[model samples]
Target: MQPHNRRTFLALGLLTLTAACTGSHRHDPDGGDQRPDPDQPVRLRAVAATDTLLAAYDALLAAPGAQTALLQPLRAETARHRAALTAGTPSTPSTPPPTTTSPTTPPTPTTPAALAVLERQTAQSRLADLGAAGPPLARLLASVAAANALHAAALGAPAEPPAPAATPTPTGTTPGTSAPALQKALSAEHAAVYGYGVVGAHLPEDQQRTDARTAYAAHQSQRDAWQRLLTTLGATPTPAAGGYRLPFPVTDPAGAVKLAAHLETGLTTVYADLVADLPAPHRPAAATALRDCALRAHRWGAPDTPFPGIPDPTDPSPTPTTPTTPTT
Candidate 1:
């Protein structure tokens, strides 16, 4: 036996024994162990949302003369979202049930407006789910949310009278939660979406129209989210008013741009408020949404706020030049 070699082997064996006793297969700091991922169940609601989206696409496809080719890709993407969410999320017996319930009403035939509306709704649900998720999964949910927003754009101009399905009303609230903050954000989203419609009509510049469309889709995504989250919590969402009075008569493209810009900037505050109210794991999502809104608002020509959405009571920005009066 080689004496030196034997000593080295003995030393190596002792080190292994020490580590085995002390460390005991500790969880990796970055990743995790075999124990179910805590964030796994957070994605179930997203899966359900994707499922709803897919169903809507299916219904749209069935209608006579609908643009099947245009919709097929969107349907495929939604299916992929559903698959990713279902695969990543754990279905352990101990976890809360995934909010995977189908709509109470049977699927109705789809119009372009209805389809666009559904796409926006599903996107919104994903936004909330994104906030609830942790990293990796959260990233996936964010991508899905973004994709859903784009899908709304691809649906093109809405047809005829808006046949928005009756979104479920929110019912109840749990204690020690951010319900009030969420409601405020939802209300802001509802108003901003309404405002954007008025903004879109008066868009004077060609480039501005592009910006308006993107911003409108973003609001639609978030608005739908507010609906689903509130409904799931059994709280009724605040419905949009029949109409909103503009601060000014948006008789020109410039007026449209100003309104669009204002809506986006205002929403930054609402999203920021939501981030503050949300639990730590979910804060990233709210923050991300805030950033997206801010960028869009900037594109619409909003001046930079030092704190973005934060209010400065002392140095308050002037009330939007647009009027706030409401009437038929």
Candidate 2:
């Protein structure tokens, strides 16, 4: 199978599970007390929100002297978010239906930084919408939220201060079930910690080296956290491999930047899986981590993807899907 196709399946695997679990209940009037699918309203609100964002993009792009070079990529990402959110729904047409913005609507901010504030607001709303969704919709909403966060960074918005860490809940664990996914996440964190060491070594600029060092330290902290979480669940965490092979040779500063992007992009995918597989209480952490990965990946020159961790079918040169191999 093609690599991107496999990545797509990994990303959407939970949706298939969600469908099988819910499909039998759809037409059961005989059961007498039918409740509506809880995800429907949340999905609708998300779709509406994306439409508003697209309108803002259209307004910003149409304005005189707009910075198309920067704004256009962000806008393109927003469009892709819209497509992902509405993917399997009945109302989605093969061709996008025409859309028009009302004259009464206020114009979007002319400055890119100001526009980024709106992007951040959209991201917050997506997170807010997460509470009511089932696993399938929740995963998509998490990706959308993270993608908007990346868009905000792309537009030069100041980073919001990190939220205080919530105590990890043990609700998602079932003897052997959550262990494998948690272990997968831990394993990826292990790679990131090692990869950043290489990144720090090869990067030439002082500021870039400092950034690499900071990323390395952050991964260490996350790696340790995952270890503790696994222990708390009575599972052994996977130990870091002695060494990891770089997907591509990191022989220069340019290569270091690409390697950093590659590492974070891979972590983003692992966390996205945790968001889907773990319980609701655990999802916010996964979502936040996913956003952090997306932001760091973009900072290191990765092309902006609408669904940050998930491979974009539209991308000709998608990131590799397999975990980096360990070298003895």
lDDT of each: 0.55, 0.67
Query: Across residues 122-229, which tens digit of lDDT does each residue of candidate 2 receive?
Result: 888887766577766777788889888888887888876444333366764434577787787777776776677677768765888877876777777777777887
Q: What is the TM-score of each candidate against the true structure?
A: 0.43, 0.77
TM-score of 1: 0.43
Which regions in candidate 1 have their CA more than 4 angstroms from the true location? 1-176, 312-328
Residue 144 of model 2 has an lDDT of: 80
Where in model 2 is the C-alpha error above 4 Å?
1-37, 91-110, 160-167, 172-176, 313-328
- lDDT by residue (tens digit), candidate 1, 44-133: 566555656666777778888979888888787666556555553335232223334455733542776677777667656655665466
